[model samples]
Target: MPIPATAPARNTKSDTDPDALSVLNHVFGLPGFRGAQEEIVRHVTGGGNCLVLMPTGGGKSLCYQLPSLLRKGCGIVVSPLIALMRDQVAGLLEAGVKAAVLNSTLSYEEASAVEARLLAGDLDLLYVAPERLLTPRCLNLLGRADVALFAIDEAHCVSQWGHDFRPEYIGLSVIAERFPDVPRIALTAPADDLTRKEIVDRLGLNNAPSFVASFDRPNIRYEIVDKQNAQSQLKAFIAERHAGDAGIVYCLSRAKVEDTAAALNKSGVEALPYHAGLDAGTRARNQDRFINEDGIVIVATVAFGMGIDKPDVRFVAHLDLPKSIEAYYQETGRAGRDGKPSSAWMAYGLSDIVQQRRMIDESTGAEAFKRVSIGKLDALVSLAETANCRRSRLLGYFGETPAAAKCGNCDNCLSPPLVRDGKVAAQKLLSCAYRTGQRFGAMHLIDILVGRLTERVTQFRHDKLSVFGIGADLNEKQWRGVIRQLVAMGHLAPDSEAFGALKLTETARGVLKGETEVMLREQVAGARIRSVRTKSRRGDIAPQIAGSGGAANPGLVGALRAWRSGVARTRGVPAYVVLHDATIDGIATSRPTTLAGLRNIPGIGDKKLEHYGDELIALVKAAG
Candidate 1:
């Protein structure tokens, strides 16, 4: 290969200029930019530094990728995972962009060749992990190369206690001191206020402009149900609505991940297990199968995050509650990446609360860190117990003011849970906890409340207390709800030393004294399955959208998808890497019959058109 000369150092032209627009149209195959993308691209291409907090699948890549192509030399992207780098490079290659990854996956000679190409200015983009990017050899190579920009993707990893915390990411701040002239952009999805500040201070991006997009992902429907036979519930959920669809099941522990995967497989669902405990080879193979094949569900711990490049995940079901609202948001946001309707369902229960709180209480971290963790857990609990729209409160947690009080996409807004005054119920529960020496869990406490003389209750001789049988007005299930709500409200907490025993917080005193009023969602019998209908933004009832991009014709969607799958198999890449679901939906709806017709659709750039245009057109014509 010949050495390519570098162009000008900076292009101050607007992103909508003819050259930028042409590149967007002919190279990337998108007619226009999404929110804040064009402005961020223009600013970075003009040699400015910035920070971006856009939701997942909100086109965060284009903010830096476009500037990389339009400016002087190759753009260096700081990716957090090797899988993400590989997926990104694969997608870029299919779009006719020269991209490469330098990670553990590459041999010594391959990495050296990539370095040589970078120095020769023969590449448009380079994705490197933070550990490798911070190395002396890699830093020196970057110094010798004609670099156009530096993009810190998943920038929130710099936070000390973030869900995706990586110690190596802190070293990335050195980039600002070493490469001062190169315009840098740091991007993350749905970061909280604390994480935002940490990214600025730790990455040395305080001086950069911050572009915060709406945290709302309108394509996803959020639902939280009380946990009841969790494995069976998950099975029924998949069977009723998401049958044969690709979804993720999250477990809080590695053992649970393995168990869930095994259970799902036994239940006739194709599933795989992913966690840190697995060998690297097995993990890699499982991840590859999940990505390259269709209709495969991966039950995983947090280990399978940020690296998922699949765009057609129909749902993300949590078998347990997440530790914090931020963690929950990031995990659930992985669904509906292609702008089609999807589901974020979670099974939350009293044990989840106890387990999460116990973990925080038992952790050996400093008191300050534990305090922050507790606060985060409290916020997530509030979200789970809220009677209002889940989206409204979820967005509010990240400091985004939603446009409406009700999102109409979540379970609460759809059914509108009945809120009843639970002040008396809360007082009774708190009083019972106090009278019983606060040495029992919710289950044992419930037995006493509903006047049940179980073996343990008889052993404890607790049936003689005044508070016993005081809660008979409410059934056992409703009393359980009241106790759960009390714990959620901080009037009650689980004892770390007593193994699921309940304890009273200082706030419990006020509730017992009738100084505070409590409102809680009334417990009601839930059906085995619910309708999938949802209200769109205009308040019109819209049928459930399936497959990618909500194509009107199910038959055409299936035919187009089969053709795309064959191509993906031939290329040895994920189907989305060949063409995103959005692109498939676009082609299916338009039914393009010619090269020119296909080129007019979004996500079909010049290289994609040249590679698969004729076959796609023929398929569409045949389906017609």
Candidate 2:
């Protein structure tokens, strides 16, 4: 493995040039851009403002980074997360690019050194927190630097209604006024119409051309399980699908995070808890361990982390319902970023819906805001309980329609459940809600169904009603399903403030009186059966056309992947970023015998071909 000499410096005067392609190869080692990346980069590099909404792991960074390098002067990127900034800087430095980040995590001396680099024009990219950018010193530095572009990563944070809103991001429009000549690019992974509108208005990107890549991550499998012995179910999932793979388990509360992590650790899994309540050093250490160690699982709350760049996470399991579909998508998107097969499993119940809604209602927001939040929560509930394809429902929320009926990825597609005429069951459940004055949640409703003469039921004297014991035909689990389905179907709404009490909506009257028939898919009976012997643990599944490694030469491809894994493990970086799967496949198929042959691969640009061509050719020849 010989290291090639550094190539001569290239001109950075124009957006389109041989030199720009060379730098693209050198820094990121990709021959061509993916999806809308090339168009977005050209737009930004040609002195144009743009807004880009790409899915996670969809190469959003390259859109800004490549353009920043191709343009004249340094690019100032305002990122919300300090960890994300550090990760980006580390990657750039490893690529032999001059990049630095100024944030709270850095010492004064360190920040001053970066500022010195900026002033000396020795840096190509500098990441700053929006809060820090508002300071007079920072503003002065920006004014003096020959800034060519300003980029706002995670631009969705500018919206107050967004899941990860940052107040400082609201003032980021000041960058436009401060550097009118510098093109501004605002980028976010997941944002709906509301968030997008807010980003445009709040960040003042009204004039910027917008680039929205498809929000579909087709490789990911989506599953939502009912919260019945959720811990055991989670254990079974991990043991079967993600054995010995890096993953994340998200919980709603800090206590749950600690408990879940402890349980997994006790069960022989390398798991750790992460939350804001943990000491800063401990949090940092845990994050580093998860990134550096293979097969490590980090159980964390919403406060723990976001925008994590780890590519090989095989699964993301949510112990509770997330606040909204956007948050759910972002969190789930963290898994399988390397275009590998991954699963997003969520275990949620009626309690999760009520609890999430209660938290939103208790927030210091107006009635209208609370109503909007509840609507979003209801949407999430619908997504969780829907019998339709989970991937289609999820992608549809992001305004994408799937090209197929069954994605063959999610639990629904893997094992389609049976549909039953739930009209009678729905009527019984709605009657209980109305007869009980909509004062109790699914538990009490279930009790009424099974004829459980609990003290509360007797105290309310509602057990004597015709609807109380009449539903005893259905068991407890069946009754619970009915209640969940009813809520999902919009006949009943959960009263968050009243601790998940069931409230009858106008639609409930029609169903309760038998005017409208409600049909629901019956829950799979005896679906929890599992053998003591675990299935063979495979690495994350790849797309069907591209198997695990997606290579043409089985032997050489395996050797190359082993080499890549070793290199990535040693450097503590993701394997895909080093050389993407498409590049590897090209190497295996073309069997590039010369540098020129390697340079012709679609994703292997001049810089990468020059640097790695000889070693790859040698390895292929040795295998031959």
Candidate 3:
């Protein structure tokens, strides 16, 4: 049951071509296409335009990268972020492809050199920002070059409804009109139906074939926890599960980013803060440190991690709610890029919704755009509060039906709670919001629910309200759930600019007047249990290592990992780069007992194979 040699390569041939598989093998180093990649590549390479909606790690790049290599002319890649374009170029170069990027970060001489290459047709792929591509001089150069294809990376940015919309991207349809014969492919990791339609309409992909890949990252475990002792919970979660893995901790604000990074560092995590507020050099340095060092934690605002190419991030923990599920999915998709198990942990409360909505309200977009943004935020709130499988809820949002009723990797699937009849509770909560003049946040509402005669309750002289102190049986946590679920159910709207004051929407009138029944569940704590189990399962994968002198065998690698783990525990260095998995796998497969044989391993250069040659050989012999 072994996979075919060409299984990973994309096939971009017409029905008449018989050597399609052969072409795939020669160019991409793999056998066949993955998912919709083959069809996408074939469509684009065969002079057909396409709109490809694939998940973050769903081989979207290969759909265009392979075609770029096979076609007769250079591919024009329009990307929003310069850093992301540079990373893609670097990856292509490492794979022995001719690629160049033109961005503002480059000096005049450097930019001119890339342009020279483009004009000479020396590059197979050229990455350019949309703003630069639309320039008169750049367009003139592109016209002269033998352009085979045009690709819009992060195509969702073109849509005003998308989480990361950019006005510049909407102008890219000009490329299509200018280069009518060259095939154009629009690619994005996360986009919904509205955004997808907007992308097609704005980018003029009217007659293009569209491919929508299933937006499910099964390898990522999702969990949402209540925001109580959030810092301690996050620390414990990181320490226990991701002890030696690269991860991101996303905060809502720059100050929170700095504070969280400091807290993680104080607790022995090698962490850094990144935000637009930081100087360019400091931000770049911190990003580099996170990428190069394993187990390094980066606490940053949403400004960070747009085009990061790190492949082994183990987790993404959000300290605040993202503006939309599309943003959340793209952010969490950064983890487990190497097809390993990873976690997406989030801690959110009513305050996050208020803050995010306030920002949205303050934006300069049209009213229709604001409405769409708010709707997306409400959908995300539903996902967070769902008592059903989190994975199913998330996938369902992107138009995929889940086969299983419960995904064993999510918080609700692992630890489900009993749903009590909260019809009366909902009515009470809604009535409290209405009777209290809809001007308070969750804390004040909780005080009224639990009959806490605090100063605020007495100062407002609102203890005399009929609904006040009526539901003292429910605890503060349960009351908060009622309020959150109300917000998620659209019965209550937390006014953004009024400092998160709770307001009873028109929908609340039904519940208040006993015309509608609201169902609610008490929020459950300790949803991290399933994620912990997944981490333990991943840890059970044995490491493969062998001796240096060809005197030992495959099992020796696992022993070396054990030894390395002990050493790393003492020295606090990650075990992966101390001895890469590839190095260990080679040693185990070859049983390289000699220093020369060890040097023959792919990742073990002479310096490393020589320095640790004796020690590894001895360990292998001891194991035997």
Q: Best by TM-score, which number?
A: 1
Candidate 3: tens digits of C-alpha lDDT, residues 463-552: 888877988988987787788788889898878657779898898888878888777865555443744434432242222333334433
lDDT by candidate, in order shown: 0.84, 0.79, 0.77
TM-score winner between 1 and 3, please give it: 1
Model 3 TM-score, 2 decimals = 0.85
Comparison by TM-score, 2 against 3, better one: 2
Better of 1 and 2 by lDDT: 1
User: Rank order by lDDT, top first?
Assistant: 1, 2, 3
Give stretches of model 3 more than 4 Å off. 1-28, 524-528, 532-624
Please give the lDDT score for candidate 3.
0.77
Whole-model lDDT for model 2 versus the true structure?
A: 0.79
Per-prediction count of colliding residue pairs?
A: 0, 2, 14
TM-score ranking, high to low: 1, 2, 3
Question: For candidate 2, lDDT tens digit of each residue in 73-142?
Answer: 7889998888788778766765667788989988999999999888888888899999999999999989
**2 against 3, candidate with superior lDDT:** 2
